[model samples]
Target chain A: MNPISHSPLSIPQQAYSTELQHHLFGRQLLAAEIPFSLDVLETHIEQGYVAKTFGIELDHCIRCGNQDKQLFYTFPCAICRQLCTYCRSCIMMGRVSECTPLYTWTGPAYDFHVPKSVMNWSGTLSEGQQTASDRVKQVILHQEELLVWAVCGAGKTEVLFAGIEAGLLAGKRICIATPRTDVVLELAPRLKKAFPFIEVAALYGGSDDRHKLAPLTVATIHQLFRFKEAFDAMIIDEVDAFPYSMDPSLHYAVQKAKKQTAATIYLTATPSRQMKKQYRSGKLQAVTIPARYHRQPIPVPEMKWCGNWAKQFQQKKIPRPVQAWVNERLQSKTPILLFFPSIAVMETARPLFQNLPAVYAEHPSRKERVQALRDGELQGLLTTTILERGVTIERLEVAVIGAEHEVFTESALVQIAGRVGRSFAYPTGSITFFHYGKSKAMVEAIRHITSMNEEARKRGLLDG
Target chain B: MGFSMANCYICYEKMRKPITWTSLFLRQPKSRICSNCEAKFAWISGETCAICSRELDESFRREQLCLDCLRWENNPEWAGYLTKNVSLFHYNDFLKELIAKYKYRGDYALAEVLAPFMKECLQQLEYDLITVIPLSKDRLQERGFNQAQALLDILQINSTELLTRIHTEKQSKKSRQERINLPQIFRVTSRTAIQGKSVVIVDDIYTTGSTVRHAAKALKLAGAEKIETMTIAR
Candidate 1:
């Protein structure tokens, strides 16, 4: 196991502890960061005293439960043992050895200074959004699980304001978690602005707010591992997104992060078909907003067969249609986002597009470049699907060079297409699928987007 | 989670393994620094100064000793300075950043970066006693560790504090004369015990010969027979 070796932080204890103990009690904290030494805390525990019943549940890691972990790793850990058995999974976050004690406080919870007015936003929700928001608020009050199946660009963040306000008024500590840092970065400022009175901390890797306690936490789902029964409202946005959908440890973290009676609201533009089946079978309470916030229909993707694209790249040349499309976009002075299946392939073809000024290519490792696209400083960006979700570029034309590749799943294709036409100012834009041969996923993605637009039109949610 | 391969601690790049029969029978040398980042490290190899072991600039065509070491070698007052000083790496920006990350940034895991070198130095050297440069309690409290002790700890090597540092103004903030003149910062804690025994002094970095020279003088006056100094980088 690669060890969970966090760089030791040297923050002054007084700076964050007072707020931390107030907001973080009845919750879990990173083992290394608690105010008192573990031995001191352990001594207090051994003398027939548990600090908080919610605290000091010492069997496995609180974050990413070490359920199937094996005792293979041996290390000289002063806190645990000279030889310690660490969990292999979630080791990226930190090394969670069996001896590392994760404590929580079972409360007669501390008193929260809930503000009289939590939300300062005065924006109006559309009728469909209003119904879903009301339902979300009701479900939170009832402490039930619900899924918000809203379309991409449906103002999903705005729709949650009412529900979050209701939670705050009821003196419930809430956490908004997502699978990726991109979403956390995008949502945190918006949330803090909406609920100005509530102290909201954005938690992510290297974030200053990691120890500074606040009643409201906006964090990546990976960060929630250190939280146990921490919140009354645990809203996982982009719940069907990668890692969250693919990794079970994240699910385990979410369960540990929220109270047993806490409401869990899953918000996603593309919930799985299995989830839909579960919703149909009454396993989950569900609501859907078919229309986008812009009141304009999504543009359906058009398929253009660019024959032997793989061969063309092998010959070190961009296919005619792909070059022509880029030329046309550049001629029109429209910024575009071209999605490639892999970084290796995209980088291979990067020199071909270098003729266009301000054109760049990026992958998951190069997230800083995404800002250049967002600032409209670039003519276009050649990207892998890391930008498939949680990115909004106005008037951006999107094209997928290899839409039929196995990497381009139906859900992924939908998200890639959803990147176009996100803003109200640019309510509609083109999404083109350039493929070697059409795969079932490509067809499904096209059908899914068309059906969604059709449904929005039928519901009179589209602008006349 | 569940990394089947080790990752480079400094840059956090995963160390990928390529299959070959050499790895089948004999494992490759384990290194915390991957080959790519490893190339960035300017090691103190090839020709070096005889006294302080700093890398020799070939253009100068100096003898075995560098100018500073030659300055000491030529000086009757500082001649020999007890024995020799050995260093592992050149104090380049790459090493400077690494030490900053390890010592100042409080990344203890980065101690692994010096583990193999520390081990090789420890194994090759013959010493009756192994001691490391110590941090004053105040500095220790601030750093949460002794930078020198961390390198020894990574390899599970035994090291004791032969001398303790006083709370003087930081050596780096001073000039060469000010540093050498600052004070007798080190005191011989157990002079009689080290009598006639060879000792090796370990430190994290060796910028000038001043700190180690002072330590060697203290040890020599305390009746130690021989004193050698080694650091992860110069």
Candidate 2:
């Protein structure tokens, strides 16, 4: 077992992949990876640039604008302190210290297999899906930045199948990148089934498919750092999702992964205000599908005023209204999801709901509980905002314990609301904001959902 | 009811625990691995082999040497050459991966994982000086750091390069019998430091007892009074 083989072992066929080839020749190659491309790489020990060469007191990460936070996780490194102060922000991927060398492949790039047809997803697209799918094809040909501002459960994955097939038919490499691992897991199988002939690999931390090579790839954005100018068309799912929305390095990775002339697509249910402004300014071409494939009205969240729920939690008690709501959901056998503002709040609430034996509370540590919930073992799951996206239950009902908290931003509230009325079997369910007082974010989230439904009605897209 | 934010190194799960007090305070100076990873180690406690310090199964005689050490006793020239050997942990898959991560992947932080255990194990033995088995010049440059030296450098005791291995095929590539039969690769250097001193030789692993035996042979020939072996695992 050669442990240093962590580099994606690109076979000669895979090495010739536009994506893998770009990565092979990309900017950030580790010292160990250089030997694999020894004949191709232009060799030079990359001493992290000479700051004083131009007489600048230079100390800022060119990659992510990371200046400080070094004192937190990586104060004194084990390796040469002068040579290895290690960046803390991106340490989870791999340590990037001053002494780390970057290799550049100067060899000729290889060619990957160009199939005659890549579109095999035979399922008929809804009218909305068809329009969005057509826009994707146009965007790829024009190499424009496109944003697919579709509502949640709008067959967003189906819309991509057409464009992916289009790209594959054109013999252009493509990547479907998302911020969350759950999306990668959710999409990999559906994508593989849609285009069964093409190899599909899903890359994530400790993923079983980490080393596999596929012409069509689905990976979390973090994995994009492994590529450089690789994709001819790049589709970014949930472009405004957390961690990715906050981490500037992930944004940098997305830009670094695609070709300079590559077409870019950003898909989201709730786009940031900046994205809306970008669309208005004609900087990004916009496509919106406000209704799901079922064309049912979205379940707008109703504010349930529970006076002093926080005070109740401190007293080691769930509020009467909250407990009553849980009892109601349990009795009706509605597999519900309760979103607490914090993990601490969720834990304090877990014991209070034990009357419902099948009811479980999950925070970060309780990832295993998610599996049980998916297995239909749990009737209800109490979670933090971690499950707001990337989770789907056929008839799942959702409630926010404290929707007014700062953590429940406008974008997050929209995503949490989007969780409900997702599957076709239900298509409509109660979404409640059990709050002490309604914040501006809560009000804005209601407005956002209402407006999307209004637009769906005006377009005559509703099934009713 | 609550979960920890700090992740376990082995399972990479956030649920196992928060960082322990020992990890917070002493792991840096001692062994810095997470408590969960430290727990995975099967510590060699209780009565151990008089020569190799490997834990004796109930089937083996307590007073007599273990099977590996007993074989050394068969060869008069190798017998009594080393006073004793002390190993801290059993060489399990976890330790194997840990050592591989350090030696192969160049993850230097893992070297600190067993520093404290090694310190405790060594305190029980008596040696005038400490030295580690050295790799050939080419292997040394290739790996950038000696795997054994990375472990010994953590100890407060005196560690010096008193011996060297002449260029030879890697010990891992050789079969058990071939490894036992290979000509001695070690040559003692700076005998002035080793001469008239009881020495403890350190290595990452004590496999087949061939490496420790060969190093001990070279040290005894260099006029060392007594030779002992110390390794992180056996």
Candidate 3:
């Protein structure tokens, strides 16, 4: 028979050391996952090539920086044979127990040599976009923070090209993080096309580029937990999105993932209350792009009383006004997006709308269905709040079936309204909010859009 | 206890335990997993093999043993070492992922999710001593916990360490024939405690049954009166 197999570390020491260095640079990995023997790690630690910290210490997760005691749990560890505390907050990535050590390379860093001119994009930015783009570059050069409070369809991603190029040419690493995976999937390709020379690592939950050391990275906020002060410049897109706005651990991960002197740029269509308060108090450097790249005002949503739509849905009938609106869009051959409060309501009312394709957060073919609507292969699609942001369809007319539901917060409604009139080819479209009774959020959403339009008009940023 | 709220260990969803008169007067046990996640675990029921507790089809009903067990029984060297093996769940895809997350990824809290089922199964078995299949020192350092022992700890069952495993290549990479042909990997640690006592062996999964059989053989050779195996999946 064959002899016992050797561990992975049995490879020649030179090749193994280089491989370990490649994986450990700019990353805080568990000691068990280092792929080499602990003796080698200890030698590296003694030589000041690696820094090791307890994975979890005194109810704190050093890797993810989760300090909440409720998120920590204890279990009897077989290796230590003692009660070990683990962080449940970031357990989806990997379990960080008290006995485990997080390793980071303190040796020479990975060198990224970028081209002189990284940006290949030829499109011209609008007057509003140019202002925000200049401010972003200034923030990056000064190593400061700035909030770009741009309206939806204002080409926020395009505005970051110059800033990213500046960081790249200066021999700095940059990362663009969003709260959702959909945004990462949407942004990575466009950023790659713009900066064709720079390596862009698109990291989400099962991304292949998780271990790649790149000059530029586009990732979800959750993916930042594995990084340790890895970026010289960090851009947070969709700063007001879910989980990022509500979860404190994600905020901690963002801070822990960036260098202490790194520049930060927050991009959002609807900033959180605290962010807006900071802007109003002159504590935050901010710029507002109220006009779309097409130099057009945002389409304000019109509130229409649909008379107890939920009750009507229970009767297996669509509301009269909502039905009329769908027919109007269908007759005109305009693609439409109908937002429901929840998946159950959307599925229940789906049959009444001539078998329109419905999508939610958990829908298997959510991307394909949204792409079909964008390509005009599907006339209209029903969706939940998951499609409120990061989905753009040309000439798309939007309507919210149950706008007064608690799920339709003011920011959500504003995002839903922003879905209309996004494309420059068809920069004008209709948005309607069909509700049983007008809620405060519906009114605020309408006011929020109207004020942005007025702001663009006052500044002469709007063409019409 | 009044109405209480707890998050599931598996999915982290908030579970609301409704208050009733019995709950007010009695100390109700809290659920470790939410109903949605708990429903995914398929319990082993209906017809099963008498030897290894593998769910059997109707075609194998006549002999009451799976074909693999028949092969093991025919081998004189391996015959009658393990009395029987009882498993709680079928080795379905969900259980496969759960085991990977629990045992390989070091999510130690997941043992609590399987503790109730294991406790129920162990209550019906007649054994004077219970012990878990030992992991090699190298394997234990990598996984950070012995999955089988973790289940016993969550159930509050004190298990004895009767066997120590010799380091070998991972069993998952070996074929069926190779696994069966492998030599004894376990050495009895405490011969006196196992002498003349009925023993139970616990493991995470019963795939080829060779691992437990090896442990049973070591215990049987150590003068144990009887040996049986218990596992979370087969």
TM-score of each: 0.78, 0.73, 0.91
Chain A alone, TM-score per model: 0.87, 0.85, 0.93
Encode model 2's per-residue lDDT on A1-464: one tens digit a residue: 57566443322332332443444543344545333443333221122110111100146443333555421122233334332344444444444455554444434543557567655667888878889999998888777889999988898988887777878777777899998887898888898888877788798877987545467889998887766667888999999997789877788788877889999999999899999998989987899998888889899999999888877988888888788887888888888888989877777777777733222233344666666666778887877787787677777888899888999998899898888888888888988898988999999999999999999899889976
Q: Report the Cα interface RMSD of each model, rounded to 1 decimal.
A: 6.6, 6.1, 1.6
DockQ of every candidate structure: 0.12, 0.08, 0.54
Can you write out model 3's per-residue Cα lDDT over B1-234, one digit (the tens) per residue?
466788888887788877788877786676788898989999988888998888888765448889888888889998888889999888898899988888877787888788788887899999999999988888887777889888898888988889998856899999989988888889999889988999999999999898999899889988999899999998
TM-score for model 2?
0.73
Q: Which pairs of residues have clashing backbones in candidate 1?
A: A4-A94, A4-A95, A54-A104, A54-A105, A54-A106, A55-A103, A55-A104, A55-A105, A56-A103, A56-A104
CA lDDT, candidate 2, residue B34: 59
- lDDT on C-alpha atoms for all candidate structures: 0.76, 0.74, 0.87
Question: What stretches of model 3 exceed 4 Å from their correct place?
Answer: A1-23, A33-36, A107-111, B59-63, B74-77, B190-196, B221-225
Residue A407, candidate 2: Cα error in Å is 3.9
For candidate 1, write residues B100-165 as lDDT tens digits. Answer: 866764455667667677787778889998888877765664445567777777777877678977
lDDT of 3 at B8: 84
Question: What TM-score does model 3 score on chain A?
Answer: 0.93
Interface RMSD (Å) of candidate 2: 6.1
TM-score value, chain A, candidate 1: 0.87
User: Given candidate 1, what's the lDDT at residue B203?
Assistant: 88
| lDDT by residue for model 3 (A1-464), tens | 23575544444433336677788877888765578878888867766778898888765788777887657888777767888898888886778888788999888777776878888898898899999999999898778999999999898998999988888999888999999998999889999999998789999998899888899999999988888889889999999999899888889889988999999999999998899999999999899999988888888888899998888998999999999999998999999999999988988899898948999888899989999888889999999999988888889999998899999998999998888888878888898889988899898888888899998999889994
Maximum-lDDT candidate: 3
